[model samples]
Target: MVDRQYTAWRLYTVLRVRSQDWGGSIVVHQGMDNDGMALAVAANLCGAVFLGLEPDPAQARVVMRAGFCDFLVNTLDEALRAMKNEVRKHRPLTVILEGDAAAHRAEMKERGVYPQLQVIREGEEPIPTGRVEELSAMLATADAAHSLLAMVVTANSNAELRGADRAIAEIIPEGDPRRAWATGAPKFFVREQPPRRYVWLDDPELEAMLAVLPAGLTIEPLSHSAY
Candidate 1:
């Protein structure tokens, strides 16, 4: 048990606390682009496993290179099956859902598969299209302070990037004393767009979910958190 704990901690430090922390195991929606890649990298640095689901072979190639376990499937059903199998096999400590995961969560509950699984939806409509430039400018301002700010900006740029509605500008305040430069705040941002939503699984909650699995079944932490 001690060895396992130490290993887990080691993995966390390597993937999450190191300078290149990407965070933890993540289950991403396959259509995510370069911006999404940046976010996944960040998450992976933080100690997370990145599971990418996409029907497009080309897109899967991109995700696979980024430490993602690719699932080549067409319909939502196929995607769900692949995800379930991965979850069962890995018993991951966390599951960060992107894209059509909410639907899968619903289906899982209805079928009494992981009936206790809860899906929290975090999304909002795209800020009026006209606001894109305004948001872009804010990102530029934030970027001057922290390079990760640029990644946030890119992640929330559009549906093509990650299907996110919000942008980096919305989260970090300009000229704030707590800016990354001054206080080194964690890079946090989310998209509130419908259909394409982001879900963050807390560590404890994920652990509990995994504990329910039978013995001999264990999940590994894919990424770690820097702070």
Candidate 2:
């Protein structure tokens, strides 16, 4: 029964990828071996073009046969030249939901009906419409800047959040002997850096350490603990 269920899931996933219109995009697989070859074959079967970056001549030949790759480039330069003329699709839209939408999202996710829907669940009270507008404005402002940095604060050292490029784990209290060694590395990283836009993430208490960062940084809160 478990095997059957797993097979059903795989079929559903293939169908989902196949249904998408990948007209002006190229799926670039770094190495054309193992899962890389699998992705190339799947993308080709879905009528999508792929670029396999495999240096091995023998392996490249194998993968090329498995799929109709636009460019089986061996180097970054070759890949760039191949993709230089291809047009790309615009960024996709993101749907942000609050309140009772959780149940509906869960149902779709469980049934693999809307496999492309990516959800970010925040356990805090629903954000006000005005606040949402404010956040949108802030995001747009940041987007216009040269660069934007995101920091995620969590108890789990290995915990990774999507869209967060950096992670702050275990905010030790003052006078704790381990505090020095625990946060020492991240200190150099956050201190005295060039002026840049920054955003804080997760637990409020733990993320307060950002306050100590250099005054030149424009730090703002993005979200609270989902717990």
lDDT of 2 by residue, 1-227 (tens): 12211121222233233344544444433344544443443333333444444545776666455432444544334444544344243221111111223343343335433222111113422211111112123223332232223332222121222112132224444543222223322321221123221232335633455654333333444342211
lDDT of 1 by residue, 150-170 (tens): 111123233433322222223
How far in Å is the alpha carbon of 54 misplaced in model 1?
A: 2.4
Best by lDDT: 2
Clashing pairs in 2: none
Query: Number of clashing residue pairs in every model?
Result: 37, 0
Q: Which stretches of candidate 1 lie over 4 Å from their true place?
A: 1-30, 65-227
Query: What are the models' TM-scores?
Result: 0.29, 0.29
Candidate 2 Cα misplacement greater than 4 A, ranges:
1-19, 65-70, 88-227
lDDT against the true structure, per candidate, is: 0.32, 0.33
